[model samples]
Target: MKILICLSNVPDTTTKAKFVNDNTAFDTTGVQWIINPWDELALTRAIELKTDAANTIENITVITVGGKDAEPTMRKALAIGADDAVRIDVEPKDAYFVAAQIAEYLKSNPFDLIFSGIESADYNGSAVGGMVAEFLNAPSVSAVSGLNIEGGQVKITRDIDGGQEEVSVEMPAVLTVQKGIAKEPMIAAMRGIMMARKKPLNVVAPVEVEALTEIVNFEMPQPKPACKMIEPENVKELVDLLQNEAKVI
Candidate 1:
């Protein structure tokens, strides 16, 4: 089995987010980039599948859509256990555009299975995986928490509103993985890190896709209001405030 895992370069969770270039683009200066956390689950599962003897998954390829700066994250994925890496040299503008570029890339090489995060941490738009599946005319399952492969078919369990659902699909499908499906991602060791430098990383330019959305401007959200304290002894006053002043009741 040849599995393709789609990764993303995103700002570290602790990085302070800002906009620049007249608030039209994200301010990447001084930002530390990392692999999208949700993608880690997919990567981990891919690695697991490759290790399983019954499945015999031969190669695990990791791909990303981003500029030059994204290569490090791709390398990181390789270091973590991906056999190879591909970086689409483009600054992703929107989910649709990114999906189109990815779909174009996959058009040439039909993979047995494709994996990606449920959503990117920065944009939080969970549209790319399904869109790519649609473009490839493959079955798609999103936010899958459990996955197993048997005889060229995939069995998946995904979380619903109150429970989980089990699904089955054949090979040559796309899956977007969510958290809780696996443990936290493992860090690359020294040997893995050294080997990653020798691994193949194919960089390709993105195919042109007419962008449908453009950012007009950006504004920070309103600051949260200060907290008001009420004395424990003022029970009646609190009730009155909830009824009349706060109107929360």
Candidate 2:
């Protein structure tokens, strides 16, 4: 069995976000980028699945849609344990375009399982996995927190309203993993980093796909107001504020 894991590079959460191109595109200047934290869960889980009994997974290939600027994150994924990597040479415009590129590639190179994060850290658009599944005509499970494989079938568990829901499905399926799918991400050891330099990182040309949405402009959220302090004796005033101004009740 072969596994395809989608990887995404995003700005580190500490970085201050800025927009360029007339406030239509995110600026990359002096920004630190890392593999999306959610994607790390998918990668580590894929690695664990590949090493389980029966050894069903022959390869865990990580793929991403971006230019050379994203190669560092791909390399980091390789260091974490992906067998190989595929870099689709395109600037990721949106979720649809990126998923279309991945789905197009899957038509020629099929896999038994595909993994992606439930959402990206930057845009938080939880749309790629389902879109890829739709384009490939494959079954998909979203927001899965636990996974296992047995006898060529995958057993998945996810949280519902109050409890967990377990399901089983055959191969050739897509899964969008959420938190708890894997613990902390594996730190790339020096040996693994050295090995990653030798691992195969293939670059592929993107298939044609028109973007369905365009960013016209970006506006950051307004600054919040300062907290107010009320004396203990102002109980009646607090009630008035809650009823008329704050309006919670």
Candidate 3:
């Protein structure tokens, strides 16, 4: 099987977020970048599928849409077990443009399966994976929690209203994995790290696409209000306050 895993680089969870250019752009200075946590699940699962004895994966290719700064994150995916990496050298301005670039690349080379995270942490827009699937004319399942390959079909379990639903689709499909799909992806070990340095990483220019959205401005949310304290002895007063001021019975 030849699997393609779509990866993304994002700000580390601990990094402080700020805006620049009068709040028109994100302030990237002093920010540490890492692979998106949700993508890690898809990456790890792809590696597992490739290495499985029952259904061996012939190749696992990891691809990303970003500039040179994204190479390290792509290398990390290789160190974790992806066979090779490809980076579309471009600044991802919007999800639609990114999906278009990926779809254009995928048009030349077909893959048995494609994987991506349910949503990016920074944007929280869960649209790219499905858009890419649509562009490729492939079946797509989003926010999947479980996946298995059997009888040349991909079986996926996704969260529903209160439970989970399982669906099966044939090969040449796309899936966006949720958090609970697998355990946290492991970091690169010494041997894997050394091996990654020699792995193939191909860089290509991004395909052109007209952007559909533009960021007008950004502002931080207002600070939370201070807490209020009520004395235990003032039961009647509290009840009256709740009835009149608080408005909760």
Give each model's whole-structure lDDT: 0.87, 0.90, 0.87
Candidate 1 lDDT for residue 65: 86
Q: Which residue pairs show collisions in model 3?
A: none
Q: After best superposition, candidate 2 residue 58: deviation in angstroms?
A: 1.4
lDDT of 2: 0.90
Per-residue CA lDDT of model 3 for 1-249, tens digit only, reads 788988889999898889989998989999888888988889888777767667767899999999999998998988998889999999998999999999999999889888889899788888888989999999988879998777556778989779999988866888989887788777788888899999999998877699899889999999988966789998888899889988998
Candidate 2 residue 18 Cα shift, in angstroms, is: 1.3
Estimate the TM-score for candidate 3.
0.92
After superposition, candidate 3 runs with Cα above 4 Å error: 229-249
Q: Write the per-residue lDDT of candidate 1 for residues 157-229, one digit (tens) a residue.
A: 9888899999998768998889876787878889999999999999998898977787797778898899777
lDDT tens string, model 2, 1-249?
899999999999798989988888889899998988888989998888777858678899999999999999999999989999999999998899999999999999999889999899888999999999999989998889998887777889976768889988766999999998898877888998999999999999998899998878998889999977789999888888899999997
Worst 10-residue lDDT window, candidate 2: 48-57
- Candidate 1 runs further than 4 Å off: 231-249
lDDT for model 3 comes to 0.87
* Number of colliding residue pairs in each model: 0, 0, 0
